[model samples]
Target chain A: MPLVDRVLLGPGPCNPYPEATLALAAPLLGHLDPEFLRILDETCDRLRTVWGTTNRRTLPLSGTGSIGMEAAFVNTVRPGTVVVVGVNGLFGVRMCEVASRYGAEVVRVDHEWGAPIDIRRMLDAHPKPDLVAAVHAETSTGVLSDIGGLAQAVHARDDNALVIADCVTSIAGMPLHIDEWGVDIAYAGTQKCLGVAPGLAPFTFSERAWARRVERPSTWYLDLGLIGDYVSGGAGGGRTYHHTAPTAMIASLHAGLGRILEEGLPAVHARHQAAGAQLQDGLAELGLKLFAADGHRLPQLTTVWVPEGVDSATIRTRLLRDFDIEIGAGAGEYATRVWRIGLMGPNATPARPALILAALRSLLG
Target chain B: MPLVDRVLLGPGPCNPYPEATLALAAPLLGHLDPEFLRILDETCDRLRTVWGTTNRRTLPLSGTGSIGMEAAFVNTVRPGTVVVVGVNGLFGVRMCEVASRYGAEVVRVDHEWGAPIDIRRMLDAHPKPDLVAAVHAETSTGVLSDIGGLAQAVHARDDNALVIADCVTSIAGMPLHIDEWGVDIAYAGTQKCLGVAPGLAPFTFSERAWARRVERPSTWYLDLGLIGDYVSGGAGGGRTYHHTAPTAMIASLHAGLGRILEEGLPAVHARHQAAGAQLQDGLAELGLKLFAADGHRLPQLTTVWVPEGVDSATIRTRLLRDFDIEIGAGAGEYATRVWRIGLMGPNATPARPALILAALRSLLG
Candidate 1:
């Protein structure tokens, strides 16, 4: 099959910013090239700014958001470490699975799949836990949890407990203040609101998180301490070689971040807000009921219940085949009942929502 | 820190093929898109051909070569499992570190850095080791080890023993027969000989290796079983969601592999051999001593001793600044004594070496 143009309105990998798309084709650079190193440093600076942190340990990991999830846990959750995870969606559920892989004594605070995380329940689950984790924007359900509120509650109870936030789908699309929210560790995907392709994970670690990092993580590839040393060269001003940095992906990310910051982060967030509002309001006009809980729905991703008497897969296939628009189907039990439509990064525009809404209207009719 | 085009004559990422570079700019595709899936399947098929393997579990991992090294061991080496590692260079040293982290009882078969692995010594390291491993090409020292001979020796001793090979710097540039040599597990990088920018690791596992895979690997991101399910799908003909695949990097890899296959693998390897020979002869004519052992030096990466009284870093800097050419300086103790140059993929041509040699001559004079 030949490559075809796609209007990616699925959970992520929405159309990247034009600058990022172009940057991918740029000539290859060696990982240790001085020019590439400068680009890398500048890229990390942009990440810190976007994450709303002054963290010195900020750079893109070589893998995607899922690796980010793995690194966050593998570096902090030693054997028998107590971890409280707010499970509101698939990602939250994944946090428990990943945390437990590193022998974390995971305390699951369960909530409805489409509902925002219950902070009170999360706080009450484990006293003086080593880590508390929550997905700021649950991509699976299109629900947005309050990371700031969760952090405030957790820190109030146990100041030493680290707060790790999954900002994979929220960064650059929503209001996020990693430092101010007391989020000790945060990880994000580039393909979502950052308007880049899916390869690199934008990761950060606060001073407290860094100080408390595992001396030697089980997984060598995702070891944050080694990666941090390589990414942010030590006080001696030389990068310790870890792995071959994905140069092209980092270049694209640098370009993508440049596009976002150039447009101004707040303006980027506003655009996504407008696009999501447009999509949700249009879906309502088409007689579709939203799936996520009211008032806590994510602005970048909107989940809607599949109307009764409609074949979900057929409509989705038609939208993709006939309209070149791709929307996401719900996972697990909600597979046939819910649809996830995203308006992220470059795709988060009034025109995109209008185009997708019209495509849906035609297909449903 | 403006982006400037430099002739990447470094150890790896030696200037991507134009086709691969162009493919990176292709429009975004959802990870689950049918077109992308077809492309991915074809890409894996190409990888099997390049790897000389019939392994059903062949696909690109969403990380670099080092992650490939990590995954190969993390999936097989359980606690107290006796594993024999041939440590001649940095990557081999890395394998022992990575394997030991997963609780493997590592037995190191030490070899000189600039020489090929001693297969006899490696076999003698452990009589009944569960896994025997060696690097096919040492990127740091530019030495090529005989993985086929090592596999034959190890399997002769114990057929149940898994033989893992690090083909990171050897894959498309040198002769590799994964199946024919009975290599149970092997992994490679894209940036070296594949003519693609770094990101994905082309990985493969034999039937025996897959059968003995760790049921619950500690690292979720590098879990081959979960990734295999998603890449190859199942008997039900549906791909399970593992993680978001790096679409653009994979596309670039697909294109790079296509370019190589189109040119013919033998032709590509011959080109690399010819270019390397030319560079080595030119360096010898310049009165520089070759570092790697005779007849074992890689036909893609050439390491030579920096001439006496000639500063390695100063010469490298001059080449980059004056001629826009980037070559690698040796790591660790050899940092000031040796220079590593690569003619890989698109840069594996006579003209590239000729240009670099002329630039070096001027600087040395």
Candidate 2:
């Protein structure tokens, strides 16, 4: 099949900003070229602004957001280390799986899939744990949790414990203050709120987290320490050679971040918020029921229960085949029962939701 | 620093094919879109042709070539599994490090830095080992070893033992026959000879190797079993959502492979060979000495020793700043003693080397 134009309105990879799309076609640069390194440095500086952190180790990992999750645990989690994970959606469950593989004693605080994390329950699950983890924006359920509140509570309970946040779907679409929230480690994807193609993971590590890192991570490629030397570089240290970076992907991400900052972070967040509200209101007007908890619902990703007697897969196929639109099916058990509609990045506008709503209304009628 | 165009004559990441560069700007596609999946499948098929393998599990991994190295060991090496690694250059030494990190009892067969791997020495180093590994093209040293001979000899010693080859720099620039030579596992990079950007790793696993894979590896991201399900799908099964793939990078790789196949594989290899010979002859005429062992030097990358009292870094800088040309410095101990001149992919022509030779005559004088 040949490539076709797509309106990516699913969970992620929304149509990128025009500048970001064009950046991918820029001529190749040697990974170690001085000019390319300058671009890399500037790119990292931009990453810090959107991530809302002063972390010196902030840079983009070569793989997607999932690799970011792996790097987080592999760098710090060691044998018999106690990790408390808040499990409200698919991403939280993945954290448990990844942490355990690195010999972490995982304590999971399970909640309903479509509900926001219960912070009190998570803190009470395992006191004095080495690390506490939660997702700020759960893509699977389209629920947003209070990461800042969770971090404060965890630090109050055990000040030594590190806090890790999965901000894959929240960085640019929402107001995230990693430093103010006391987040020790965080990982995000470029596909969603960043308005770029999915390839690199925007990752960061605080000084405290870096100080307590494991001496040797099991996976060499995802080792944060080695990658940091090449990407962000240490104080008074020159950049070291690691793996060949995906130069074109990084350039595109740099352009995407530039677009977000040009629009202003708060304004970008406001746009996403307005688009989500429009989408939610329109879904209700169409007689559709929202799946996530009412107050904690995310604006960028709106999950709605499949209407009664309506075939979910058939509607999705028609959406793609007839309308050239792409939305995501719910994960795991909710696959057929729920639909996730995204208004992220460049797609975060009132008009985008209107197009989807009109198409849905026509197809259902 | 404003994205200046350059002639990338580096060891890897030579200028990408025009088609591949344009493909990166193509509109984004959801990873699971049927059309996108079809393109991915075709990309994998193209990978098989270049890798010279018919393995059912062949696919492009999300990360670069180094990630491919990590996946190879993390999937197969169990605690105390005996792995014999032939160490001649940087990548081979890296394989030992990765395998050991995965708890393999690694036995090293050390060779000179610029010499090809001795298959007899590698097999003799560890009798009855679970796996035997070597670099087919040592990118750091610009030397090529006979993986087919190594595989045959390793099989003769122990039929059940897997034979692994690091073909990162050999796939499109040289003659590689994985199945024809009984190689059980192989991994390659897209940056060098594939005429693509450095983001994806072309990887394959033979049935025999897959049968003996460890049940649960230390990494969740690089797990072949999980990745294969989404990329190549099992018999009568559909692609299960693993993680969001780098769609743009995959599309670019697909277009790159298309260009290579269109030109014919043999023609591509011959071009690289001719370019290397021309460069080597020109360097000799200019009183320069080649670094790699005679009869084993890689045709895609020609390593030449820096003349006594000559500064390596200064020459490289001048080439980049004044001529807009980029070349790689040697790795590790030979970092300042050798210069690697690559004639790869779109840059594999006699004219490319001639330009570099003229530049060198002016600068060195």
Best-matching candidate per DockQ: 1
- Every candidate's DockQ is 0.88, 0.86
Local accuracy of candidate 1 as per-residue lDDT tens digits, B200-283? 999999999988989899998888878888999876878998899999999989999999999999999999999999999999
Which regions in candidate 1 have their CA more than 4 angstroms from the true location? none
Instruction: Write out the backbone clash pairs for model 2.
Output: none
Q: Any idea how many clashes model 1 has? A: 0
- Fnat measured on candidate 2: 0.82
Provide C-alpha RMSD values for all models, in order. 0.9, 1.0
Task: List where candidate 2 sits over 4 angstroms from the true fold.
Answer: A234-236
Q: How many pairs of residues collide in each model?
A: 0, 0
Model 1, global lDDT: 0.92
